[model samples]
Target: MSTEEPATPQLQSTVSKPPKVFSCVLCAQRKVKCDRKQPCSNCIKAGVSCTPGAPPKPRSRRRRVIETDVAARLQRYEELLRRHGIKLDELDDPVISARPGVASASVDGANSSHISAVVGKDGLPLYAPNNLWSTLSDEILDASSDDERDLAIRVANQSLDSEPSTPPKIELELFDLDTPLPDLSSLHPEPLQIFRLWQTFLDNVHPLTKLIHAPSIQQEISRASGSPQTFTKPMHALMFSIYSCSIASMRDEDCMEILGEDRALAHRRFAGIAKKALTVAGLLTTRDTMVLQAFVLFLLSIRNVYDAQDLWILTGVAVRLTERLGLNHEPLLDSLSVFNAEYGRRIVWQIAILDGHTAGRARIDTSRTLYRGDTKFPLNVNDADLDINMRERPQEHPGVTEMVFCLIRCEFGSQLHNQAAIEGNNMLRLLGNPSTPVAEKETFISKLERIFEEKYVKHCDPAIPLQLLAMVMVKVMFGRLRLAARHPRRFRDRGATMSQEEKDSLFAICLMMIEYDNQGHRLPGMHKFMWHVKANFQLDAFVYILNELRHSSVGDRADQAWREILECFEHHSDVLTDTKNPLHVAIGNLALKSWGARESMLAHLGQTLPDGEVPRPISVLRSQRSVGVSPGSYSSVSDQRVAGEPTQNQAFQVANPTPFDSMDSTPIDWEYWNELINASGIMIDETQYQQPVYDARAMNDWK
Candidate 1:
């Protein structure tokens, strides 16, 4: 069978012999199988001629990467990035690859070897703060391209390097730049005094401010105790500010009791030293954060020492200093350690708070640019939870921490007016918005109040002084916000009379607020904060209560109103006698008028005490002396006034009547008083407060 086998046929195309047909070219090109016949099956079916050709040559080894070749290719890529103004270092952003007209090449920005930034949880790269004049990085990618990122970093570094946020250089007699710096060793408190001053600050100021990390600061104090010379200038400044502030918080009697120094003498001595220390520390141009801390403490502690307007101006400088330092730019902080970042947030927030309060008191709206910041809120954890070397962020504590007072206050300001949060709901705007209904405002306030109560207030132990302060402050804030929701202005703008029930509601709240104010200041353990209490004279409550007493004279409401009024005056006896301000004059007139109305109504009704003891309000009102009015202002009101006209014009028979005046009745102008009250503004339970408009230092106006 093999002898007669098929002859060996030579394969050919129609035109010529195929070059040693390795495979059927027609089938090979078409990627189909061939039967190896003169006409392949595919061609046979298609009815076309089949062509044959040799197989393609074997593929050589893939070209190896040579230096020049690789370099040239990389240069081409870098040129492309540069053309788009995108740098290799900032190529962490995939958006660059998608920019208009960017040729879509094989390179993928996400997976590019050029990017080395730490990918965040959301897949974007986290930006670290950059150095301005850094040497070429060892990283090849950074060396490979120049882009916008490098330019931006250079600009930022230049801003920080330049004299940014420089407050006017502090100038003091002992700190003349032209002269050699004076010896400040005597300014340092005695070794025992340091502990006492530090402890006093912890008890009186630290709980409210929470600016300093207690454990760390205490450690630093211990390390530098025996050798005060070792303390940095900024720390020294902070120390002197602490000394002045502690002395400021105490009454002269309390200072004598605790530190055995007269309050006025101690505060003057320490405050002067603090000013000198601040000047020496170069607070105006220093980039150090500690210098800013000392500056803030100094400004706050000197509230009563400087004019209110002067304090307001100084606070503006602090704010500018904050911005120039990039404390408001949160991205700048991403590279910082956890503890440092947290500390920066605290300082930034405290500065903002002080700015608000000072501007409020001065009735001058300065810059409020901090409101637009995206900085994250400080975590609510105690000082013990943070440390210098911490890597991972500490979890926030669930219960009341020492930061409770400060955090709540910061939260309230940031959300309500400051608008510092990136996504914070403007619940405060609702309280003051003209368009919002009273009911809706109340509902929103209730929700917010519940959050404060559950998160902070409920966990507080009243026995703790700070917690007690927080409790009263929270109530006062909610009450004020609620009152604002239903304020007379809300109805007045539309020319609507507040209904009897609304009037009663408003009356009760105003009286209640005054009561809270009295209670907050008069509590047995609240003496330490009395300086602040005395500084923040809540006159609006008095104004509103006096107006209410004018319309409604003799009911239980009047009795309660009279009681709160008398206690408030007794608590702040200095306010009753000081009449320099027109606002104070108006306040005095309203108080006397209200008291006269009470006596007349009681006298007409022949009302008598169930007990022989005179009512405390009556007794208090009669005994106190008021400015421009004699101590004899209430002399006509007999304790046994069961008949006849009682105390006729007794409250306002000017002690020395001017001969030119005809039967004068100094009727209080409600509109003018309204404007004055608006100017002497009340903040919502802030951690820091500004000095009152009245001159507190020279007059000893604080009670």
Candidate 2:
């Protein structure tokens, strides 16, 4: 081994290994860790790309945060300027424009040794003021005053125009949002036009701007107010009011920023404008008084000063105002009335909903349940669907008359004749038993009857009229309608249809009832009918009744129906929390099973079958069918035989004799079983029950 056989090469151990680290191009350039991937973390942070194993580059040194004497001194001056409402940004750069306190001298005089000889005590040359040019100084002074006034007027004008255009302009970004408070002087450079420019600026800016530019605006405003300039002209006062209104509506936040956060300060500013509007309103002639009453009321309402009294005052003035103005309608008063009425109705409903005590039990929950479950069936009425939106009167807004009707139906037990008599008698008595025409009395009864009839009548909608009638009946008959009153007779009678004209007349009456309730804004027991009917009745007949109620022009039951219908479908119950009301599970099951289709055949039966014939299944079913003769012919002899001694066996027997009967010489009772099965609608496999020992009644007892 020691033999120097080609001297053994010195062995050296060497290891090939993977690179220890990788880097992205950006990270390497920044001299930071790479954590290299396709896009390394460092690269991603820098929003650049990475390349693995790239050689790192040296990073440039960062600039130092050194302070210069000039910058430090300038910042101090800017801070001081900010405190005095003089923005440093307003200053010129490179000292081109004259500084406030600096003075400029004539150019030729500046270089004259003789002029320079006129020296001050400190050896600085004495210089006359720029205004030393007597004529030019006067002109310049006059121009400056005119400019300030112009800006002021412009600001005021802008404030006036801002009211109506503010919301939309702000929304559309028509103006500079970042620069809400623009420098009026910059916007209008002419010194003489400054006042008008300021007025425009004020008008365009928020009323709160007064707090920021208080010194300037207040000074001008005070000067304007003190001067003999009287806004006695109607146009001037009106313009002033318009401006004031716009100012009143400025954003509270913006106002708070200018004025202290104390609302009293804002209120003080608002009071000035509010008084202006009130003054304008009072100063206007009868006709013009209500020109901006809507806006006035709106402002007052927001200010917490508006009330029913103010509403009435404005509305009262409006009656004569429109007439005097020669306007066809008092839109102002109309708008006021509508607004007040809506708010009033909402208030009434809120109170009603909150009131814990009432004579009648709260029927909303039970009604909802019944409507959701049992009500899906069509009432002999028409087109009632699970989606309540299809109904005529919303459950919540049943008209007073309809509310009266709902209670009546529930109270009188759907007995139209009996209830009609009682209601008519009561109404007659209420009319002081005066002979107010037989038709009026009859009309009243008919109204009551229509209300009840709708609950169980074909194609009838349970509208305001019906609900009102129901409510009335409920009141009259106490809490429960005498079940006996619904005695079999009422359900069986199928009556003739009313003429179109008559239906229209009834619809008109319903509308009147709704209006009445709306005006009163308080009808006892009436609203509950709306809530209950909406909550309860789901039968097609209910909708039909509502639609029919709408036949009359006066029946404004659509809204009531719309709301109730919406609630029925849209108002969901929490399945977990609503234990007593397993409405969700039940509704889900029903929806799954029926696919939203109603089994409304029963409702039709309620409308069709006569009261006494309610128990007869054939009568119930046949009422909805067309009346005509059957296809078979029967002889008098066969009829006689069928009438006499027609036992169950003979009742089911076929006319012709069969081979099986002949083989027995005794009639088999199989025919009875067959007839029973047919009547019961149950199919029996002959092969399965052919033992001939099947009990017919037991087998088809479902009947």
Candidate 3:
């Protein structure tokens, strides 16, 4: 039994075979020991999910090969520089010899001594300060060949061209030496009339502008009106501009009429007086804040009346004057009265906002001229709390007011304008270098979407002022529209492939903008100038809907969207008669044409009308349907496009139900209509549809 020897005790392997190597994949990759468990100790300690797998293969080592040619070339260059008594280190040290005469040889005595010992120079150190050639030697050597030097110069020139240049200063003579201030006594309304106009201005225009301090202005007007005191030209101008804007904003026709004169003509006369005073008084050179405020008021009064080009120039001049007064710079807190400083800040920010807004509309770049720096935003305090000596902190929980809303709008516009400028520059760079990676463009777009979400989308509170709400909506929609415009083909392709949720979001944004515009007009103290502000936003929405209809694959959805846009336009038809707002009128006319064309197309498709007539005017149909519904009622357009129901035209009859129906006899020129449709980029088979009969009466009224 002993000889059997327990099967001759197989020699126990002394080497413990490398302990299984059963660590999780992550631990193994990191070369850390892991306890063999479902979730290994290392993974649990590291707070990572345990993923166990077989040991990973070791990565092969890559051999590093030195470039012999490059090393030899650099050695030879260093040797050559040394032979010429030029040390490479000396040429490379920009801090030592940055200029012609100043050179920092050493930071300390010991270093200075070491440098002197190494270079065999006493006190002179390694390099002299007066040697300008030391810095240029490397460049000179590198650019030895003529072609190389030419290339260097060309690259330098390209860099210079790419860099933004400072704009030249504009100097304009403020005073007319020959022309005197116009006698404004004849133009000035009576004292009672002035008081009434001032009250109207306070109610309608002052809330929006807020450029003037009401207390100061009221006191000035009272003192000036009390006696036969001679007022300064600028004061008179300010009063006239304020009154003119007041009268212009009055909705009542009789209230607007002054001294039995046409309201618009009377305002124009008052504005002319203000202009003459500004010129004769040399207000530009005076850099008077009151005069500037008056000028801005005058501009507001004539916004819809003047050519856009003239307005743009005038605004630019005002901005330059503001900058000249140092208003663009934040006032030192201790240097001026709190009221004066705060007012100055408000005026500058207001001008900057106006400048950016106008520049955007004009499609011009004024960012270079518009100073946007560390200027403080005005405190969100009401005028009553602000006085000459007292500085009031804005309430932590301030209620929404006209001033507060305007400030919010101004801030939003500023940020949006800056973003647009940045994106524009990036796009230009991409255009210049077509090889930019697609991932970079995608990242840029993602960032823009994030910005929109954070800035505009997140701040949509119903309690905010309607003007502010509309402005925010417009900013968001415009940003998206512009992004789409940049890649029209891509956008179209994406729209074609978009899911139902995405399409709904697009439609919802368009619908929301239209709805907001309609809602804004209903608010009390809503100014006419708001129409100018919302005009582009409304038109952009219209364009967005049209684009969707033109490109969407879903016919039913497109029809529903088109019907909604038509209904929105029909509801706001009064805008067509607003002669003062040409932009609104133009948009209204386009909507009318689009609606009429759609109705004609449906009629041509043999869709039965409600009255069983093939060719009744759209106005008559709209009036019949709107007879019972409230003007502000929001009916979903999709509901109207029922699957089995007759087309939208079937809902109306030939009963003349609208003011527009009286003008239906005037025929629209078919050629012009076709041009408008084509210009809009909507592809349609015109031959399949008859030219819609234009109301001669409406056309005459439009003309």
Candidate 4:
């Protein structure tokens, strides 16, 4: 009304101005005030073109329709297929849908229908034309009748009931001990061949335990050759066992040439024959010393071939028989021949060694079985020093015969007396008792250290045979390792807890042991011993050194140690590849993995360092050096000396007293003996001491 038309009456000056409320399109979209000029303020700040336009339209509010039925059906089908381990992607075939009542159909010129189509006169349907059930009797389709339907349901129910609900279990066959024995005469080799094998056994295996009197065995062999019928089953078993081990100990190529077959196969055949002879001879039920000796020999023969548990159980049997026959007690010199009594003493000590060794290896506590107070160590003399009549006694010299070294080893057996300590030292048991007092743990360590110094260090001769020296060193090192592994502060920083000197000493011992093992094969008769145990010693050293490298703060030392260990491993690569000792092979591969991991860590560290900076040696705590002790020289003990009494010159003495000492005691430190036993690497679960079959392949795979 106030426009130019109404103002026409007063037409003086009625000019109209543009509205300020209107804005440019950009400003309206941003909901900001605009100047309404050609280029608005907001458009100028945004550096965009400005244009006049209408307001934005409101979005429609239409509701979406959902297919709930289809969704529910799809979920149900997915669930049904999952129950049978079937996936949607696997159901590509039209005939294999998860939905029920959806039978596939086929089309033909004559008929096209689903698989459930009506049957024809020939009892065949066009649908499912290739189905074999189409030719079945029409009675199959007569279930429409009440009686037929009831029968069909009953049959289906019966069939379901008959089917096993769980998968069938597999059963393993047991060893057949009753297998017929091979012909003894046919199995017996020529006289020269037998002599050669016997010599080989004497040179290589007998030194392990000089239980069998060589002269007596030779006499028996000579007599048996004169009269074939006199060659008893025990004797046959003994010869076969020796031959088997002798052949097995030879170089693979040499064994193949001698046996004209693969070394393993030949050994198997010989071992089988030996086992049969042992069964037929009834040695397990016999008290004959020859049979006992033969059985023990058989145990040695199978040390590397059979299950460790089997050997352990067999050793137990030998111990029991020896005890029942009074071998564990001093022989009555008045009642028995001197040769027989001496031989009995030898056999008893041999069994003791075997018992202790097997128990240690199997991780089985032999404190109960090995406690023999009256049993004395055999005389430190060679087999040649004694006559059949025992009238000639050779003058005893230090380290002259193998018995001297053996008795030195036997001295370590005394530590087994502490049953609680032995049981507590177990790796599994130690790990479980994490909260055990540090002081209490130190007591065990101190005890082990004392035993090591007195028995092995003070009493062991450094100049002893390389093999014996190696054995002593390995036993001592293994004992130290066990104690360290059980130490409460083992995982703590080295400088804060375990001194650098202690670490260096431990590492040095490991290096020495590895070097010793590298040269072990060169030792005379060393091959006759359990090479697996030696290999395991190498592995243990490797593990300890690896731990050192991982924990050592001194970068240069750690790097140097790694190089030495890696070189050691490479040097023994041939032995590691020997398939005969699968355990060693597995340990070798594990060592390689550990080495690779160490190298990767080193590489990472190298990359993380500053470009031009040299790595400085980290602060690794060093400890004071203690007095270096060597093994004591062996001194002969008189037969007149009471059992369990340390010889006048011998440095080892029974430090700790046990409750059973007054009952039946021996010089053997049951605790030290136990430690030495475990050093052999023959681990077996106490619960599975008598496992019927030990799957070595499974053990290999497990490692």
- Which candidate has the highest lDDT of all? 1
Q: Sort by TM-score, best first: what order? A: 1, 3, 4, 2
Q: Please give, for residues 1-703, the per-residue lDDT of candidate 1 as tens digits.
A: 6654443332224446654545577777677777777767788888888776566889955423244245434644564654365555445567664454333222332222122223321243323211001111112211113432232223222333233311222345433553345466656877887888889898888888878888888999988877888888888888988888888886677678766878878887888788778778887878888888888888878775554445666777887887788876678777778887888888877877777676655444333322335456678888788888999999978788878888877766533433212225454445545467766776666766787788778899988877888887777676677666666543322213444445445555566667777877767788777776666656655776775555345554455557778778778764544332324434555565555555555555676433434455444333432123232232233221221121332212212111111111222233334444432333322222321111112122111
What total of clashing residue pairs does each candidate reach?
A: 0, 100, 6, 25
Q: Model 2: per-residue lDDT, tens digit, 23-119?
A: 6545655677666677776666667546666455689553221322233235335434543545343456646343443222222312221111122
lDDT of 2: 0.27
Residue-level lDDT of model 3, residues 489-592, one tens digit each, is: 22212234434433444444554555555555555544444533433335445554543432231234344455456555554553433222223323433333
Over 1-703, each residue of candidate 4 has an lDDT whose tens digit, in order, gives: 5465875755544345434446777776677877888777778888988887555568955321133224323543553454344544456666555444333222221122102224321243222221111111112212224443233333223323344212122111113443444577677666766776777677666765677778778888777764545787778777887887677666567666555677777777777677676766776677677778777776666665554444656777887888777776653532566566777877766677676556545444444445363555566677877777765445665443566445544543333223233455643244223345434544554565565465345644545553465455435444443434332122312113443334434455555555555555455545555343342444445555543433231244444454555555555554333322223322332333333334344444453222232211110000001111111111112111111332332211112211110111112111211222232244322211211121122222111
User: What TM-score, over all chains together, does every model reach?
Assistant: 0.63, 0.17, 0.53, 0.52
Q: Which model scores highest in TM-score?
A: 1
- Roughly what TM-score does model 2 have, to 2 decimal places? 0.17
Off by over 4 Å in 1: 1-176, 366-371, 417-436, 489-496, 535-537, 609-670, 675-703
Instruction: Measure candidate 4: CA RMSD.
Output: 36.1
Instruction: Go through the candidates in order and give the C-alpha RMSD of each one to the true structure.
Output: 30.7, 40.3, 33.1, 36.1
The worst-scoring run of ten residues by lDDT in candidate 2 lies at 369-378
